[model samples]
Target: MRSCIPNVLLVSLLSTSAVICSPAPSAPPSKGTTIPLTRRSVHKRSAAEWDEWAVRHREYVTKKYNGQVKSKRASGMNLLTDQDADSDYYGSVAIGTPAVSYNVILDTGSSDLWLASSSCSGCASSSGGGPTSAASNSIPLFDPASSSTFKNLTTPFAIQYASGQATGTLGQDTVQVAGFQVSDQTFGVCDTANGVLSSPLSGLMGLAWQSLASSKATPVWQTLAASGQWDSGVMGFFLTRFGNDSHAKELEPGGQFSMGYVNDSLYTGSIDYQNVPSDQVAYWTLPVTSLTVQGKSISLPTSGSNQYAAIDTGTTLIGGPSDLVQSLYSNIDGAQAGTGSWEGYWFYPCSTSVSSSISFGGPSWSISPDDFEHTQVDSSGTQCVGAFFEVNTGDNTPGWIVGDAFLKNVYTAFRYSPPSVGFASLSSTALGENGVDGIAPSATIGSPAAVVSSTGKASSNKNDATRSRGFSVQILALVWGAAGGLLLA
Candidate 1:
């Protein structure tokens, strides 16, 4: 939910060999369409700040669904404070009649589409009460008054997070993305948002099902799928990496987000599909059959909710049940539990190759050592934080949150028709520095090649592959003006 991008929704027609676009072609629509995603590196913060943010984030998420807090602001807490920023990968979306664009994070963990209103109380242009970060100043606010078709529903809208919150009113308008437009799409127009909008990002676009939407509105993708706009009810992601590259830019090409079909060239071999259990169909939840460290299987919770996992693109870290997480690190020599501000976290030697894999009733997919070994935890340049964290979601929610740490290792597809998730190995060309090729070799306690710098950046020797090509489509582009008219491309 913390990523960034612009608001122009680029729709692409996909084929087997190359990506090309035209204006108003006669060919039928392809099976799938794609949108380009941009990566925004987070501003640096202390490790303690990150730890504190994580704790609060878990509490907020837990409370949100526990019925402890209503969808509207039940705690009268004013939205303030700067939440620690996480590395974000987002894209553009255009809403309203005039087709104004806004950058939004594409999140699968939660379902709700919202934009910061131009009349936001905490915005820099409004009364002072929001984050004063320079990045927050650059975020564009959506002015519902400017859109001729905007309709206020008069329903209260509010969602509270650990360090920030957004409170506003529900509205209906035309929501456009990937060349498809949904008329009267219900979304929140926040009059006040705190610590949410960052530069180049004005809102969040949730991709999960309607059951999880706080607004009680059907998600954009589900709307499209129900309308038969896509040949197949499926969406796929191939997330790229830039954190390890010393020469990484602020806005790099993150990866592709495909709708309706999977790009054959992006992944290798056949995809292993896992059906979502009936009880966990709200999100992309799958049963985690097994977990292994150094090629040795570890004991997992046999009963209760600990076996289920939600594959979330919004989250940056891999999280599991407390006991399972402890068992995972116990296999790695020199691994130790973090103390004080870093409780529920673990750290290991920087040079340790902590090769790991997770299974979802299919072929085991390996996690890269580079992904497992996170940031540096010690000034002596020895201890490094592990990407895996401990989450106590209780027995009602999924016990595991499989996030970018494990996601970047494989090409993932979310199918709507049958409610299943699939994973495939990345093709040779698609495999970057941290991409997994196959089942990883057993981990070594002191592997020199896996050693990172004092700053915890990956070695410069790792190959940074060329980014995947952007997709395009041939359709009549909709150009809207204040006069409420559209011009065909």
Candidate 2:
């Protein structure tokens, strides 16, 4: 269950954290290129108020799961309906031949690209920037009628998330990101949208695999990879957080999303890689060997079919089985069951530090303590909301939803060849510990280099052949084509 209760609201209700590791050296950054990313605050809502809403979303997910599980068991269905919301990183893209630019949120959890349409009715409409109101120049919408290269497809499309639904016409056009352009890209021009999707955000670009896509059309990244525009087929993400803390306070120039190559300087230590299970490949899901809080292991059942966890950039909070969630908070000092602020939410003293981390396959990756508290009342107040919540996926499989709160600590790489995800600690510079020097430092000592075999192991540092950075551009392009239509925005 996903909540459209506003991403900021969800942030104020959950808590979690992780640790750091020494950095590693790489041959050099692949001919990868990066596009600037920025954080957009979900303004106007109070911390307490957002917490209340977030708790309700947790209950909603659980309630919906319980109700659906019974029917699914009786009917023997295996489809997964994941939630989407609370994205903070965004970049710009242009659609059509003339290239009309629109600000779009990049999401790794879902697989679909959608934007507001000129024909949208009963939707938030405005223009220009600076605190917009409805019924004006909200955002520049795509009009298929105006674009000479637009191809109107018969597929009527819709996507549902925690907040609301987006229903629109499916069409194809030339889409441009930075200077690279992909022709005949399929996307949705939403005529109707619900929740607070208007005003600031104009569209969403999905980055997950094509199996999760709403349309059969090829994804944006697949097209770009096949276009021979990049040196490698890989895509990388660096997400920034918003707050007063030095570690995560929003970036001055902001975070970034790299295409075709990984940035060697944005992270430290070796990256740990995990293959997305064949069944869960549609999402960037991974097997979670264990979960710990401050080095203390939380006893989660190891014998369940739902042992995997989805590392979602589109989501804002961490969630899991009700029991596991409770157990995690039980170890924290001053953590309490939410009361007037909200239910289903666990509140802890603002000063509480949860040394939390999660293991996918290899060594456990740590989360920063500063990322744990989503909301704080008064500077010296007694309570702050956490970033972990309880949400049951409506199936016997009990998977975890790991979101931006946890991801911001690591530099993630989505490799296409072997269908795996890799994580390494963010560079100290990226973590904001040294100073305001915006430049990312060289990676630290570790073995997150590319895989040498199908077993997901790092090769010897002397050989350095395991890392995919040395792949010829032609080979990389072929891998991108063989990667079977996964998309990224």
Candidate 3:
């Protein structure tokens, strides 16, 4: 889930002929580009704050899944406000004419693009000048009136979440990101945004398929793919970990987002690709073939629909069926399930090193032990919350929502041409301090062959071989702090 809800909202756009919006060359470049993501941190949360965020986060996940099932699309998204835990990653994108760049969350769970307008009602304000750090409680607003190419689509946009909502008007303008430009891109410009946006982060850019878009607008990525601008319809992510780093700063380099190719330096061995089921095309939904805890295989639901898991980069935690979650934790010593206010969660002794892994029709990828330990729960710091929580959608929605907890463990790639997801073992440098918990020495890392499609065919295209013709947007990862509050003016 994004820090903001995925509610329906509207925005307007203006045109620009700036250098950033220059036309693409006759031939598109083939090489993939990289974007840096920043990981922001906030002051250590009290037990109460953690509890509040957990409750709200659970509610948001429930609503997100339930809404998707009922509507055949994600109805709303839960965005983490500044007051919540700091776990989201952000990248910058320039919109409108003259190219005003704003920091937006790059999410794969939904489809839609929205930004705060200059006239936004409750949006947070930046401290003037550009943001110095991820925690810099600053946001740059987009003024449609300043762009000569701006055009109002006259569509009302609104999205509601468990915490807040953003409502505005839909419009079109040129959008530039990762060195690619999409002209007349449809997006939202909010006039009333409360709880939906946070400081230092102005908007969200959903990278899912168009069918999931609430505004019925083609996502910037899809637009790029349709225009043959992408060398390959592949985007990969390498999310870094900072929770356990004592020397970590409020704004620190997090990871990389690769467009059109995979960065071999980020991971080792060959990539394991899993095809997204045809019917489950809305999100990057894949079937979980198996799961294990402490080297013991845990029984999973045999029902096809119940085994699906959505690879969500925007979400900070891993959520699964209540029974499975309970069973997994039961394998850990001193693990206790929460009750009442803490229901749907699990807690364990801080000293326990929980080792777990999951598979998607390929080699099982190990999750780092550090990722399992979410945060310290008690004042004495003897107890800690488990990153894996219960997400009971009550319907035939994907049984798991795999977020950063699991994603940070591997180098993940999403392919559009064949609608598949791939996972590879992280390189030594990318793995850093938190190595794979209990991955067996015999575990196969696959072969460095072409990516396999869902139909069992090998993909011949090389994502990194060709270079894009124009300037590329390097997506860098940075750490940011949450806004003070969702102030409504």
Best candidate per TM-score, number?
A: 3
The per-model lDDT (C-alpha) reads 0.58, 0.53, 0.64
Give the candidate number with the greatest lDDT. 3
Better lDDT candidate (2, 3):
3
Off by over 4 Å in 3: 1-35, 74-86, 125-137, 394-396, 432-489
Off by over 4 Å in 1: 2-35, 41-86, 124-137, 432-489
- The local distance difference test score of model 1 is 0.58
Candidate 2 local lDDT, 112-204, one digit each (tens): 677777676534421122223234554456667877888888678765534445577788886655334456678877776553343334576
Scanning candidate 2 in windows of ten residues, the lowest lDDT window is 474-483
* Model 3 poorest ten-residue lDDT run: 439-448
lDDT of 1 by residue, 1-489 (tens): 421121111121111111111122223234434333444333343455455544554554444333221322233212111111123345556677566666566677767788878776644221123234333445567788888889999998876655456678889887665544567788888876543443444667778777777678888777766554455667777776654554443344556666556778789999889998876767788988999997778887656677888787766667787888898998999988887657777989998888899999999999888778666655676888888877676456678878777877899988887889999999875665222222211101110111122122222112212211212111110111112110000
Question: What RMSD, rounded to one decimal, does every model reach?
Answer: 14.1, 11.5, 8.8
- State the displacement of the C-alpha of residue 144, model 1, in Å, after optimal TM-score superposition: 1.0
